[model samples]
Target: MFREIPTVNRLLQKKWNDKDQQIHLQKLKNAKSTFNIKKRRSSSRRISKSTSKKDKIQEDRFKQIERDNKILLQKMRRIMKNHSGVNLPFEKGSLNKGMRKKQLADITLANYQLLQRLQDKKSNYNVLKWEKDRIDNKKLAQRIGIFSSTMVDPAHSKSKQALPTLKNPRESTTRMTKKRMKKNYQTELQPLEFPSSFPKRAKTTTRKRKRTIATPEEDGDKAKDLDLAKVCSIPEEREVIFQASKNDGKKYEVEISQTEDKMFIAAANKVKHSEHYLIELEKEKGEEILKEFNNNFQVILDNLKVISRRLVLLNPNINDPKRANTTRNRTRKKNFRKLNKRGNASQPSLRPGTVNSPSGDLMGVMPETARPVSPTQNTNDLQA
Candidate 1:
């Protein structure tokens, strides 16, 4: 039975080994099939990815080429426009460094020439204008009698030569007097003939008096007193009355009284007639003075106006010949003259042959008569 058991165990072991071997083989076949399928799928995916990448690269290259072509076209058009009339090696293209520098130099030279021509024309015009102005000024000066024919030449003018030698009248007189006095003094000092028997006069000497100083006792007695007066007793209240006169021949009273506190107070029953009269007098005096001042001021103003009118008529801005000839200035001056004439004509005239005084009165005329006449008329009609 033990030998049979060994055979049976061998047979079981063999069968189990066969079953295990079959299972392992089946697993290997399944694994090989799955691996082959996976490898085929991977290869197809790689092929598709490579083809797509190539197509994208080609598209990008074509787009970049199109952009570059557009940019080049724009540059070509700009170069053609800029170099239109310029003779260059490239007729319709951009210039190189040397060509660009040559073109800039040519343009600078043309600009410089144009500026020089303009300056020359301006200088010529200025010269002509200056000559004309010089002639006009000479004529104006001659007409005004400011420059005579001979006086036009400064070197020939005697006044110009003598101006440096001229001295103030008072200074010259003083210098001449001093010189004569010096001569007289020198002549007087000459030795005078005298008799030998004449007694010699003694020279008297003068002594200066000295100032005296005050002693302490005298200074003490001379000290100033600054003490206030003392009151002995308080007095009873008393009223003092004052009367004043007015221009109307009326009298008013002012009362002054002493208070218990030693203060003196003044009270008026009514406004003082004298104060009103004084105030009225002051007002009248002030008005008279103001009237005199106004008359004098008006006389001066009229004289100034007349003088300014004469001056304007004489020269009319002779210093500036250019401004004097403008149409606007001429019209303005005409209007001013018309206004002045109308004002002068409208003003009342003074009595014939009456001289105007600075105090706004006519000489040899009563104040009443002068008061009726305008002060401006007398001054304006007086000719130098």
Candidate 2:
């Protein structure tokens, strides 16, 4: 029995040995394949002697072509120098007059064609440059806030007058008056007066009052005395008294009297009459009707303001969120749904699923089912 158990163990060991041997054989075969691949790569990268010889031949041929080109260019330059006129170098000393004339005409025609080409190119370039300048000027005008017909064109600006002109009548009048004053002053000679030499005095006068004795009499007797005093005070008698004086000093008399005529009386009367007439006309026309309409309109505006204030007070939730929660919750739910929809639209599918999955499953094999039409595509289709 022990011998049979030992034979069974040997069989298991044999099976393990066969598996290990197969694994080692696979590793050795892989190593040999890799070595062969490296050898092939190295051999392919090596350059052949025949290719190097071919490269040298090609280089020599290119050099010869370059040298030939340079020699031809030098010969052409010499020929051009000898025949600088319209005549060709080959026909420079030819005795055939008709051939020379024909060559000269051909050269002139070629020159005219070249000149025309050059002129056309120049005109095209000028037109393009003018268009660019116009675009740049428009952009500059926009930046400078100048949007009106008065914006001057740079092309036509040269013909405009550059010097300043007198366009304002008031300014021109002031300049003319200043010139006239300067001319008048130039012809006149006057001595300048100094305030220190002639001191200024106040334009006011004072009078001496004559003393009168009060009479203790009745009102009628007082009135009679004043009349007699006034009759005795005569200007001629006073002048005679002054002339009879022995003193050589000058005598002056001042009189104070009230006059019925005034300089501003007529003007004051006319102004008062005009003001009274205007007041009467205004009353007769009932101009207060305009004031009544203005007052009523103002009252209506005030009432509207009051109603708006009351409405604002009643609906505080319009600005304040703490006043109500139902509206806030509704708005939050709407915004949340909108954000979820946008996220679903923007995210790509990373897992296998049906095309019509409610949660936005995008995996599918068919082209029409794999990709969904976006809002932008719909808008483009509509526009088209």
Candidate 3:
């Protein structure tokens, strides 16, 4: 048994020689062999302190990572909501280590890319509108003889100070989109309505056509009235009767002679026997042919039935792009084509000899008799 602290205190108070101190203070590898309790407990306490410090360091690092992640997510949400008017949530805690880092990096990259795209589109629209307004202003300036070339103002002042600077430069895209919650998704949706004073477009009507059948002329068919002799070079003779064979188109002639009548009678008797033999042969072969056809008739019927059943059972592809009958994909392609048409879209050309007012509404065209104001024109006459 190990002695208590009071025994160790009494031992320490007694002065001992160097060899006796060393023997008593010696440590052993085996726990049962060790006699000094304080030495063993002290060594264990040192090891425990090192392990605890390491665990504390690791725990602190994990907590720091968690805190930073929360802040990052908050900033991303704020940015998305401000720019796109959509508040999106990021998936957290579901990933760890490499997967977690990858998720956050992807989210940040996506956010920046989406932000850039939205801002660029908005800036591009603003730039196009600005260019259109500038062009319209130039045309108006030229019409009133206050163009940059003339360096004249509305008051017809010759001084440079009278003319407003035409260079209203545009701001950068970053500065433009820097505002938070700019879209402000609180506005109510409204249907568009044209003002009552707007002119109505002309309505086009389609005309329907009636189908009529043709009737024969009252003068009778033209083919029956025409003489065949006038159209063809072949001669029509009355001495010998001529008939054409329906099968071969060969012309047969009969002459009123005794030898010809005898030949015709003998030919008719031979033809009757040959015709009777041919009819009997056909009847003999017909039965064999019918038997052969009957063997495969059921098989042909079964194949037709199988094909019909497969067609009825097969499902039709509704949204497949490979199918030519897919109307959804076809309509999607049409919408893409419609969106592609925007490149050529521009504001309508200004009316000739006219200018838009300060309010952006187009002013009425000038009278034909009224000529353009020259640089030398008086200001009072223009005002009137």
Local accuracy of candidate 1 as per-residue lDDT tens digits, 1-384: 123344557878778778999999999888744354442556888999999999999999999999999999998999988886656574565548789989999999999999998875633355656776777787876665433455654454445334455667775467889899889655444433444674656676687668653222323222222111111121344332222211222222212223333322121112221121101112333234335334342232222111211110112232246655776445544544564666752332222211222233222212222212234334332321
Candidate 1 has an lDDT of: 0.42
Give the per-residue lDDT of model 2 (tens digit) for 207-289: 76686533233344332233211332222221110111111121111121112220000000111111100001122122232
Model 3's TM-score against the true structure: 0.14
* Per-model CA lDDT versus the true structure: 0.42, 0.38, 0.38
Off by over 4 Å in 1: 1-100, 103-126, 146-384
lDDT score for residue 261 of model 1? 30
Model 3 / residue 200 / CA error / Å:
33
**Which residue ranges in model 2 land beyond 4 Å of their true spot?**
1-96, 112-384
Query: What residue pairs are clashing in model 1?
Result: none
Q: In model 3, what are the clashing residue pairs, if there are any?
A: none
lDDT of 2 at 55: 96
> Model 3: runs farther than 4 Å from truth?
1-126, 146-148, 153-384
In angstroms, the error of model 2 at 355 is 38
lDDT of 1 at 322: 64
- By lDDT rank, best first, the candidates go 1, 2, 3
Considering every candidate listed, which one attains the maximal lDDT?
Answer: 1
